[model samples]
Target: MQKKVNLASAGISAEESQLFRESITGAKPIAQDKIPPVVAPRKLKRRTDVLAKALDDNLFYFSDEFEGYIAEGVSLSWTKSGDDPHLTGRLRRGEFQPQVILDLHGMTTREAKAELAGLLAYCAKQHINCACVVHGKGLGILAKKVPNWLIQHPNVRAFHTAPKTWGKHGALLLLLSVED
Candidate 1:
């Protein structure tokens, strides 16, 4: 297929276009590893506040695990619930403990915050498989800032939006593992 352009003064003919295509034909496809993974913003329910602070304090003992991934401005003293298992999937973080949150409809942000830490610690203590977080999709409660907070939390495994049958992204399915 010779794609010719009428460059009359240059003296280049239609046949020359074929050479340009042939020169690049042997290039290999790019490998998958060359690209970085893309993560989406997930939903998290935050109704409780007082408990959130307690959970923040609770994580203080495990300062070593909070070594690298924390946000620069966030205080080391300030811990979010489920802050124990941040990014545990690929590291030598030890146990595979998990926890779940159920039916977070009427709970206040304070309640939710408190409950998150309590649940995380409980799950870690039990060495459970995984827990279900039930944050029903209502009037944009946790959609604003809760998930972002959880994203930085230490105990979190990998939380994604809940399935339709499981209350959708209004709820987050938390996976907890032991701290390294």
Candidate 2:
């Protein structure tokens, strides 16, 4: 002899049963077309300043911005001297240097540029002089933009495409300028 389970003890009451039946069987839902949706079309946010400077319809190419960047050079004198032994300096320090690496995967030119600016700002704030940006293999996207952008940035002293183990073709070892 087995005992039957009482559903009422499970907290499902008669009122809930009545409500469910009324909602499913007695209710006639209004047509979707009869209801007006509450929403407006959104406007696109664009940067007029960037558009004005970018001669090409596209903003990522090596344009005058890059050319001008190459013309001017990193002026701040940075030495391999700093209290933080972990931070990479202007010159190669002994093994204690930290690998300051930035990853820019899945970023548009505008976003990447902004991020690069942020990194520069970070380096400036932290007094970090050297860092690496891992861009990922020639995913064939954001390719030229990374190098050219760094080339023109005010704080960048020099940058070279990284060799294999670090990130191969996808990374750049950047030498940043130190502040006075």
Give the number of the best model, judged by TM-score. Answer: 2
lDDT of 2 by residue, 58-90 (tens): 333334345332213222112223433333232
lDDT of 2: 0.59
List the global CA lDDT of all models. Answer: 0.53, 0.59
Sequence-dependent TM-score of model 2: 0.47
Once fitted onto the true fold, the runs of candidate 2 whose alpha carbons sit more than 4 angstroms away are 1-98
Worst 10 residues of 1 by lDDT: 70-79
- Candidate 1 segments whose C-alpha is farther than 4 A from its true place: 1-56, 59-99
